[model samples]
Target: NQTKMFDEKKLDINDEKYSSFGAVLTDDNNFYFTSARNTARKTYGANEQPYLDMYMATYNADGSFSEPTPISDINTKWHDGPAAVTADGNTMYFSGESFKESKQFERDKDNNLKLGQIYLFKATKTDGKWGNIQPLPLNDKTYSTGNPAISADGKTLYFVSNRPGGQGGNDIWKVEVKGNNTYGEPQNLGDKVNTPGNDNFPYLTTEGKLYFSSDGRKGFGALDIFVIDLAKGTEAKNVGLPVNSGQDDFAFSFNDSKEIGFFSSNRTGVDQLYSATPICGVEAIVMVRDANTGKPLASAKVAILDERNNVIETRTADTNGKVTYSVDCDRAYTIQASMSGYENNSFPIAKTHGGEVNVMADLRPIVEIVKEIEVVLNDIFFEFDKSNITKEAAFELDKLVEAMNNNPEMVIMVKAHTDNRGSAQYNMNLSNKRAKATVQYVISKGIA
Candidate 1:
């Protein structure tokens, strides 16, 4: 997995009362998200939903956010924000289509002036109100710059922009966040993180890992969340499901104090918020196949066994001959696969040390063809004139029992011959006893 699975929980859960799309949890017990639920706001012509407004709520101790209230001072007639509050929770940077005095209105592609062309706006929080808002210097009439994410130290600012010198549509760009609201020159994030597709909503973590959404790279859906570790390298890896769905999933952020994460997805038909936590366990993908033919054995039952060799659970293989088991890390386990007409096979899985891994089980087919017409058996020897079956003679008798079981309709003739040292009557009597003992032995082995 380029990314691990997220133990996700949907906060909205089919309650589409609002269309919320981003999450920003701050150290000051503040939670921020963008939504179009405010009926008082004017509707934008693009989606016909109420204009997006910045909403603030309390991050509860129970890992739930309080009822969100729009930041009325910051919310304007046009779209307000999907914001990033700094580590100190004092300075905030957000994408807004509202600032009126910042150069009137922005022009569209047809040179039409409208309430579009989002730009990064910096705001300061004091006494529970957001004010002193000013657009970043990088915003221009020729291009659009928005979706701001700042580093923990507030020195670097990462954002999405279709501004000049980009890979194509929207590329992630970063700038230095100097003191006094002044900034450094913006630079593109290069082709590695920025693809020709639409990449937006960048979220920076304290560990220098940047989580963002993009349609440029191959993903489960249109906009899938991806992360790139600045310390590791710049290969933006997709954060696999259930954080990523086959629909739009974006704007991933973490709350380090609570050890919880949050993201937004339209997988429920409407954009909604989802809380995510890292799944801590091992994922074993068991692939069943034929031992000789190397073909997938679908419908095969795969069982996970504990250390005591008792089956914990069993799962049937899908069309791809694959089934997965979630087990504890650094633990030994056994997997057994079985299918009709194929011998059951079991394989020991070594300790995974906590990661996703692939395991294989090959089943040999049980050949049922009987090619022999006449069944033959070697002579069975016994101790001197004894009626009891000896260990050596029992070995040959077991083969006869197996043959009788293999061919249920075939009958066996027991002819126990002995030496000429005894009388004819005594030899006959001895042979009868030996034959009876052999028959009893076969019956003891549950053979009819």
Candidate 2:
């Protein structure tokens, strides 16, 4: 049930008359969402085309909601919906769009009024009333920006934008929330999270996980919800299956304390809300380092191999010599670390019941040279009459394997000698077997 935690049912709160999406909740069970159904507004003078607006409702204990009403004080003639409130319940950030009053609501080429690009606005709650609405300083009148999500501490704000300097039609961006109602410059989320298509509706959880929607990345629909571990710097992963379908799926909001969340999708041909529960999984972190010097090996290739030695995923170690992968629980995995001048090392991760697993892949440096023999392996002593490899023999042979990898074209011949304590015929046969086994071990390491 990794991505199928919910049955994908449209919320009963949705009205057949209009599109509903972008739902967030307060601790008191009050729901705030976006809807285009409430088109009636006293501010519109004439010929006001219907647009989305923010609505509020009280969620009843019987799984029903009170009659939803638009938050009239915040609605505009143009689109105004989708909002995120701070944990303190004192501040709110929401989407807003309208024809600029500075431009006198001028019309564009299509006889449509020039759009005042969508941007996020903030409002403060004072004496149980929300007012003092103001646009964020980063908003630009030319390019659109919306879909605000604030961190639990209110120190960071994440949103979507179609502004210049983005990798796609719409990309997610974030800015540090400077205290005293100011913000730092906005930063694009980069190519890993942004594509040439739309990416929007970024939601940051208290645990530092980023959940967003993307039409650009590979997904199950036009826009599917995806998540990434901001702390680990992993790639965006689709929250597939029941939560996603062959339609647009976006606007994911979750409350960690309540353990339930809602996301919007158009699977039934109309945008509606769906409840979802978070799924549990395991994360594997592989740290690669030098065995001798104990220094972090940056840019080392780390491959995650399954039980059958099949390569599942490969990643390069960051500057900290660490790479992480989201893996299933109760399954064995192997991590193979390889660097240019180091002997390849493999570490096995045993099956776990489900939790974080840390692996250390310490690689031994390939000894440059010993004598003129071209290959200087460790002293691999064999038993009195045994030809099979032992633990010590295998450990020593790894050096030979390392040497062969360092000099790919170089070749060495295995010559085995037995002590005079054995018969000449028996010694001859024993020597031949030892030589064959030594060659087999070398070949197993992908060397001649």
Candidate 3:
């Protein structure tokens, strides 16, 4: 059935003792996930729970996963799981509990572990073999950073951290890669993407859509995955169940199509894997223009809304003076076009098909003239004191020709005038000559 895409499947390796959390897909069709499986056997294992370790499992094209293998180089005795892989599969970013010897003194005011830190590692292909891992430079002593979502260009990084001076809890932060291997200081994404409640596990799509899990708002339970349109403001919306059952559905990753993604969830009794399929449809196109002059306006802004006045898209007209957009069909779209120097134009358009449809709208400029003033210059003039008609005079005469061509019935009086530096009679003779020269230029340019 089509609904098979939303079906949840229990991962085979999970036993009663271990917990599985964040998971990601590698380029070679192998899956990488964080697990606390075998690490529970070590002495001083803290609470005897599994310390997170990185594991890889081969995935068949038809959607079956083989047995997982532990990645030895980066995993350690302390907790190290919750991982994100870059698109090229050459780099990884993940969170880990610190293995510092002075761990007892690393507790915060609430007596929680303060030594956890995020680490960046690079993997290079050498002589047909994957090379050893190298750590990134930004690891600091104070704040713990993890859960990275690298932008499609691999230039910007988004991660989660509970460092001091945040709104509260673990806030989402980002850092832009300044150079080939250097990154700038991390900055909080602010109240839009962060909350007083814990916000973590950021997954960005190739199209710049951000998906993350949070328990901040009312949800199924624990951490529920929410989708936020990064282009529009940072408003978040719960993805809803059965994808987000009353359990933690965090650490999500998606393929390029965005139609499918994998998330670790405890909804089915254990923190296993679940897949999701997105509902698909074509979007409608809306175009706005200036109705009076038929001229496209660059500064015109458009707001498309539904019957409930909910904004579907808010876009500004391009330099061609048109705003092109797509929305689902059969919905009532309230379109409002406004510019600072023009009156606002508001109307409603009902889309029927999911194809190209043009909406012609024109806005009038603010200046009002009681009577139309027409200035017709039929003659050309010399520049400064020369008697020859310059190119500027020819340009003005071309406009007169254009007006006559556009309005066949319009008649204009061609008045030729000249400065009185010469005798009045001489000036009149010069003006007549300039007027004849202007008409000859227009005719030569094929302006009827």
Residue 68, candidate 2: Cα error in Å is: 3.0
Clashing pairs in 3: 284-326, 284-327, 289-361, 290-362, 291-361, 291-362, 297-321
Local distance difference test values of all predictions, in order: 0.81, 0.81, 0.67
What lDDT tens digits, residue by residue, belong to model 1 across residues 263-324?
99888788998899876678798999988888999998998988876779999999989998
lDDT for residue 369 in candidate 3, whole number 0-100: 12
Can you list the residue pairs that collide in candidate 1? none
TM-score of each: 0.63, 0.64, 0.59
C-alpha lDDT (0 to 100) for residue 229 of candidate 1: 79
| 1 or 2, greater by TM-score | 2
Q: Name every residue pair that clashes in candidate 2.
A: none
In order of listing, the candidates' clash counts read: 0, 0, 7
* Weakest lDDT window of 10 consecutive positions for candidate 1: 366-375
- Candidate 3 stretches with Cα past 4 Å from truth are 1-17, 43-47, 100-135, 179-181, 282-448
TM-score of 2: 0.64
